[model samples]
Target: MTKDQLKLRSLILTALFAAIIGIMAQLFIPLPLVPITGQTLAIGLAATILGSRYGTISVLLYLAIGAAGVPVFAEFSGGVSKLVGPTGGYLIGYIPTVFIMGLYLEKTSFTIKNAMIANTIGMIITLIFGTAWLKIAANLSWTAAFMTGFMPFIIVGLVKAFLASWIGILTRQRLISAKLLFPERLKEKDNKVA
Candidate 1:
């Protein structure tokens, strides 16, 4: 493909992943402070499949849409208010979480093992951001925040991480084989020492 064609494809895929994140956000088991949602899994999938640049772009687009009052957040909520709300930290944290996850895979290899590690790390990052913000935003003690915000999600987060890794690697490989995604060789070259 030409440069413009590649750029267009990346943009399209990025927007599609953003939409996927929004859709996944709706699949939540509600909690008092924060809901456990499929958003994290989608974020992982984006990173694993799209790599750092497009993956992070997808996350940024997702956040921008939520911040613009699009009702794309968990429980069908959205707006700048949601971004600054008690649970907003988790939402905001998605940016770094997806970026780092993608960067890890980009620097290493887009294998299931690497994706799992990256997703696990991403999960921890999200929880930390959420817990810290929960403490401040909800006026809860650190202990309370840990108990409520962090603890409840540990097992569930691990499950999601596993799912993201397994599914993401499989899908990425398929996409590359089908020429829908840029090949892994290209990704390696993109990260080669200069």
Candidate 2:
């Protein structure tokens, strides 16, 4: 594809992922301090499929939409209040989580193993941000934060991480085959081979 076509494809895919994140955010099992939402799964998929640049852009777009009071957050919450709310850290943390996950895959390989590692790390990063913010925002003690925010989600997060990595790699491979997404590393390898 030409440069303009590629840019348009990126833009469309970015917007689609952003919408996917928002939709996934709505699927939540409500907890006392925080809800376990499918947002993380979508985030993982975005990174694994879109890589660093477009993945991060998709996350930012999702956040911007939520910040604009579009009710795209978990439990149908939104606006700047939600951004600065107790769960705000988790929301904000998606940025680095997606970026690092995508960057990790980009630097290494877009295999299931690498995606698993990246998603696991991304899960930890999100929990750290969420737990820390939950402590301060809710005025809870460290132990309380750890117990409420961090402990409960470990197993669930691990499951989600696995799902993301497995599904993500499969989907990414298909997309690459279909020419919907192209990895820079693959391009470089092609050029070198040529």
Candidate 3:
């Protein structure tokens, strides 16, 4: 398949996944500031499968949609207000996390053994930027900021990361196998990668 076809298909899939992630925001746990949702799982899945470029684009597009007043954020929240809210930093952090996770997925061979490690590292990246942004935006000290913004979601993040990594590895394997063994999707696009 041609690179262009692959890029287009990847972008479409990424956008679909972004919408799915946004919709998952409806399943939220109440807490201080931002509630937890299953969105990050989709973010990780996109990064692992689509690589950095399209994966990041997917996330950016999702945020743009939300910022444009689409109810695509957690708790059915959207618009510019949500972007400037306390959780905005965390929302923004998703962009870099997905990109970095994609880099890891591409650079290192994905295996069950490394999945947890990769997820942990990626989670840390998200939290760092998120926590820092939360601090500045909320005008709180680092400790207080982390307690309010980061602590509440640690357990949930771990659970979702585990699930994301597992699913990511499985999905990647399936896609690679399909692309190589079947190539039907490629043939439809005239043997293009997309």
Top-lDDT candidate index: 2
lDDT of 2: 0.89
C-alpha lDDT values of all predictions: 0.87, 0.89, 0.74
Listed in order, each prediction's TM-score against the native is 0.94, 0.94, 0.85
Give per-residue CA lDDT, model 2, range 1-194, as digits (tens). 79888788878989999999999999999988899999999999999889889999999999999999998999888899998889999999999999999999888778888888999999999999999999999999999999998999999999999899888888877777787876656743221200
- The stretch of ten residues in a row with the least summed lDDT in candidate 3 is 185-194
Cα shift from native, residue 162, model 1 (Å): 0.5
The full ranking of all candidates by TM-score, starting with the best, is 2, 1, 3
Worst 10 residues of 2 by lDDT: 185-194
Candidate 2 — which residues are off by over 4 angstroms?
187-194
Give the alpha carbon lDDT tens digit for every residue of 1-194 in model 1: 78778788778889999999999999999888788998988998998889888999999999999988998898898899988778988988888999999889878878788888999999999999999988988999999999999999999999999999888888877777677777435754332222
lDDT winner between 2 and 3, please give it: 2
Candidate 3 similarity to native, TM-score: 0.85
lDDT ranking, best first: 2, 1, 3
Count of clashing residue pairs in every prediction = 0, 0, 6
Candidate number that wins on TM-score, 1 or 3: 1
Q: By lDDT, is 1 or 2 better?
A: 2
